[model samples]
Target: MSRLAQFAVFGHPIAHSLSPQIHQAFAQQFGIALQYRTIDAAPDAFADAVRRFFAQEDGRGANVTLPHKHAAFALADERSQAATRAGTANVLTRLADGRLAAHNTDGAAMVRDLTDRHDLDLRGHDALLLGAGGAARAVAWSLFEAGVSTLTIVNRSPEAADALADAIGEPARVHTRYWDDLGHIGSFDLVVNATSAGTLGQSLTLPFSLIGSRAACYDLGYGPSAFGFLAWARAAGARYAHDGLGMLVEQAADAFQLWHGRRPDTGPVYQSLSTRSS
Candidate 1:
C-alpha cells in the first residue's frame, strides 16, 4: 500500500480551521488516503513550520491562512501568476524535485462562488470592496479581471486603499473610497466585506446608500465571524447575502486540484458543509 499523503492548513489560531474536514471529504470522493491537520504556528515561526512540513517525505501540500499567506509566498521556490499578481499565496505544494510551488486560490474561489454559484454577472458591474487587507487585495484583482466596470475599494486607511487601487492598474475602472466617505459613494451591484471586523465580532456601519434593493452582500470571513455582516446586510435590505463558506470550499477545491491532478466535485461537499453549519 502507498504511504498516506499528508496535508495541513497553517494559521496562528488554526484550531478552528475547517480545512481538514473539507479536504477529508474531498479525499473520500477519490478514495485517496490522506492525513490533513491544522498547525498553530506563530508569526515568527510560520516560515520554519511550513519549511519543515513540506520537507517531509509524506507531505504533499498545505494551505496557508490569514497572517501567513505572505510568508508562504516568500518561502516558495516558484510562484504561479496568480500568486505573483496578488503578492501572496494561500496554497503550497511540494514538487517532485523538492522545490516548493505556491499559488493563491482566494481570488479564484471568490470568483467561482460569485459567478458559478450565485449566478452574478461580473461584466460591467460596479463593485464596492471593503478593507484593503490581503484577502481584499486578492479578490480585488479577480473582480477587475472578471470585467467589473468599476471597483471602489474602501478602507480605514486612505493610503492603503489608494495603493491597492494603483496596483490594480486600469485607473479608470478602479477607485478608492475613505471609510468616512462610504455613504457618498452611491450604490454598487456587489458589496464585499473583506474586513477583519467580521472575525473580530465588530459590526460595520456601512452607508445605507451603498446597498441598493438589488445589491448582493458578501462577507469574506466565514463561520461565526460572518453572522454580524449577514445581519447587517439583511437589516439594510440587501437582496442577497452570503458568507465565505462557499469561497472557502471552492478555494480548497482549487488547492486540491493543484496538489492532486483530479479535481473533486464541490457540490456535495459544499452542501454537506452548509448543512452542518446551519
Candidate 2:
C-alpha cells in the first residue's frame, strides 16, 4: 500500500478542534491512507510552523483555523477565488511545484450545508451575522455569492464590523449594525451566529427579538458549543434551528477533495458524528 498522505490543521488553541477526526473519517471512505494532526501556532509563529510542516517529504497540506487564516493567506504562493474574495485562507495545499496554494472552503461548505442538506435557499433572504472575526470573514463573501439578498453584520465593536462590511464592498447588500442598534434593526429571514463566544463557554446573551417569529436560526458552532445559541433560537420561537456540524463536515470534505481529488460521501460522516455526539 502507498504511504499515508500526511496532513494537519494549524491553529491557536487547536486542542479542541474536530478537524483531525473529520478528515480521517473522510479518508476512510475513499480507502486512502492519511495521517491528520493539529498544530497550535500563534500568529507570530504561524508562518514558520507552516514552513516546517510542508518541509516534510510527505506533508501534503493543512487546514488553517482561528487567528491564522489571514496569515495563511499571506503565506500562499497562489490563492483560489474563494480565498481571494474572503481575504483569508482556511485550506492550504502543497502544489506540485512545491508552492503553497490557498483556498477558503468555509463559505462553500456553509452554502452547501444550508442549500443541500437543510434545504434552505438564501436567495433573496436577509441574514443577520454575528461576530467579525476570521470565521465571519471566511464566509461572508460566500453568503453574498450564494445570493443572500442582504447581510447585516453586528459585533461588540462597531469598527470591526464596519471593516468587514466595507471589505465585502457591496453597500447595497452588505451593511454593519452596532450592537446598540440591534434592537432597532428589523427581523431577518435568517440569523447566523459566527461568533467564537460559544467556543469560550460564553453565551451570546442576544435579545430574542432579533429573530422574526418565522425566521430560521443557524449557529456556526457544533456539539456543546452550539447548545447556547440553539437553545435561544428555540426559546425565541424560531421556525427552524441547526448547529454547524453539517457545515464542518462539508467544509472538511472540500479540503479533502482539494488534496485527494475526490469528494467523499459526507452523509455517512455527518451521521456518524451526530450519533457519536448524541
Candidate 3:
C-alpha cells in the first residue's frame, strides 16, 4: 500500500476550518491520495505541535491560521519575501534538509481575487482598509505594491493602525484614520474589511459618503458571519460586495503548490463550496 501523505491546518479553534475539504479537492484533481485534518493547538503548545507534525515521515505540509501566523514565522527556518514583509506566515512545508520553510500567501491571494477575479484596477486607486491585525498588514503592503495611490487604514485602536503605517514607511502615500473619523473620510474605489467584527457577530457603521455607488466592498472573512459586512456594503450602495471565499480558495491553492509543486484549478472547488453554502 502507498504511504498516505498527511497535512493539516492549525489554529486555536480549528473545528470550523474548511481547509481539509479544500485540500482534498485539490489533491483529487491529480489523483493524489492524502489525509488532512485540523489540529487545535493552544498558543503555548503551537511550536512543539508543529515541530512534531513535521518530524513525522508522512507529514507533507501545514497551514496556520489566526493567532498563530506570527508564531509560525518565528518557527520557520526560512521565509518567503511575502512572509518577511507581513511578519507572519500561514503556510509551512518540510524542506529536504528537515527544516520548515514558511510563506505568506494571504496577500497574493487577495490581490489575485481583486484584480483577476473581480477585475478591479488597483493602479492609482484609492483604498480603505479596516482593521490593523495580521490580515490587514498582510494585504496592506500588497495593495501598495499593486500601485494603489492612497491607502488609509482605520482601526478602533488608532495606535495599531499608526504602527502598521509606520512600518510600511511611506507616510506620504499611506495614512491612518481614526475610527471615529470614518464618517469624514471620502469614498474609496475599494474598501476592504479585515477586522474581526464578523467573528464577534458585530457590524461596523461607516458614513454613506464613504461608499460611492461604484465602490467595491470586500470582507476578508467568509461563511454566514461574513454576510454582515456584505449586507452593510450593499445597504451602503456599493456596486460590488463579496466575502472572502475566493480568497480562501486561492490562498489554499498557493499552499498546495508550495507543498506538491502542482497548482490545482480552484474554480470547481470554489463553486462547490458556494453551492453548498447557498
RMSD of 1: 1.2
Each candidate: what lDDT? 0.89, 0.89, 0.90
For model 1, state the Cα shift of residue 226 in Å. 0.7
Order by lDDT, highest first = 3, 1, 2
**Least lDDT summed over 10 consecutive residues: which range in candidate 3?**
51-60
lDDT of 1 by residue, 1-278 (tens): 86678899999888999899999999999998899999999999998788888775457899999889889999999999889877889999999999999999898899899899989888988899998878888999999999988999999988988988998777899998778888787898889999999787687777678887688999998889999888888888899999999999999999999888889999999999899889
Model 3 CA deviation exceeding 4 Å by range: none
Structural similarity to truth (TM-score) of each candidate: 0.97, 0.94, 0.96
Write model 2 residue lDDT over 126-209, tens digit each, in one string: 999998877787778878889989999999988988999999889999999888887778898899999999888997888878
Which order, best to worst by TM-score? 1, 3, 2
Q: Say which prediction, candidate 2 or candidate 3, comes out ahead on TM-score.
A: 3
lDDT of 2 at 79: 95
Query: RMSD, each candidate, Å?
Result: 1.2, 1.7, 1.4
Runs in model 2 lying further than 4 Å from the true structure:
none
Candidate 3 lDDT tens digits, 1-278: 98788899999888999999999999999998899999999999999999889895457799999879999999999999889878899999998888889999998899898888789888988899999888888999999999999999999999989998999999999999899998888889889999988877787777778896588999988997689888889988999998899999999999999888999998899999989997
Highest lDDT scorer: 3
- Deviation in Å, model 3, residue 155 alpha carbon: 1.5
